[model samples]
Target: MKTYCFLFLIALSITQVNAETSIAILDFELNDLTLKPRTAAEINRTASIKPLLEKELKNAGYRIISIDLAMQQKANSGFGYLFDHNDVAAELGRTAGADYVLIGRLHKPSFLFAYIMGHLIRAKDGQLIGNYISETKGGDEKLTLKGVESIADKIDKDLDNRYTPPPPKHTTLH
Candidate 1:
């Protein structure tokens, strides 16, 4: 009975330690567009990149807060907020109850290519955890999704590097 109880406690502790990190991803700001007469479809396609990024982060064992919720919080806060502003990002993280915040911009150098740059920020103190930049070539939809995925992969690797636990020490019998 005691052994079983000990095993249960160990399992509970392990589950707590392995809890998924919560993150909130903001919309990617658009910049330097070369597309002539941006259509509604192109704008919508560009906006959809946030969800792809969230899905990738979720697959990487992160809990994602909804972008809508984050935006609403920003609107309620009554400030001309910027994602690069640490205080604003941190406040959004707190409002959304996220452990970290991901914010960045998308640049379209031409009609056929898109570039994305992202920054991962710690919520508690608003310190920059890491940054990633990636580019993809194609139409708006394809390029935006591909660029976001590449950035997500970079962020996933960064999280893995930061959060992976070290191996337990071994002791040999003397």
Candidate 2:
């Protein structure tokens, strides 16, 4: 009986480890309030940042929901009006059956500097699980990707710390 119980416990632990968290990545808003005018190409490049973030998160072991599905759900649920509100994001996550949602903005104040800011919200209660900000010099594509990579690394670490089960305590025989 004791052997069967131990085997069952081990099986449960393995099942828990195999479960993957689902996440929804929203489109990043752009805030370029500087005097320098942005060309069409620049705006398009900025808009492309969200996919990079989604890819990074997916690579970090999260199952990322399709943005198209998220948008469709958002419109159906009347959450499109609330924009980036935490509640709205959480609702979208719920609609998509995701465990969490990631929302953020990219700000380019000038031609030389850019900032990436993001927030992770839990879908169950709309709690802010993590917030990250990264600044990188040079607003070019290479620099922007580098900045995003930095922010993604931080987010991955934060999520791992939050969701990873604590190491099991071991007992030593006296």
lDDT per prediction? 0.72, 0.73
Pairs that collide in candidate 1 are none
Give lDDT tens digits, candidate 1, residues 6-92: 999999999977988888887766665674735665567657878888877776678997656547454444322454576678667
In model 2, pairs of residues that clash are none
Per-residue alpha-carbon lDDT of candidate 2 for residues 75-102, written as tens digits (9 for 90 to 100): 4444223345678778778877989888
Q: Lowest-scoring 10 consecutive residues by lDDT in candidate 1?
A: 160-169
lDDT of 2: 0.73
Q: lDDT score, residue 108, model 1?
A: 67
TM-score of each: 0.73, 0.79
Off by over 4 Å in 1: 1-13, 35-37, 67-81, 161-174
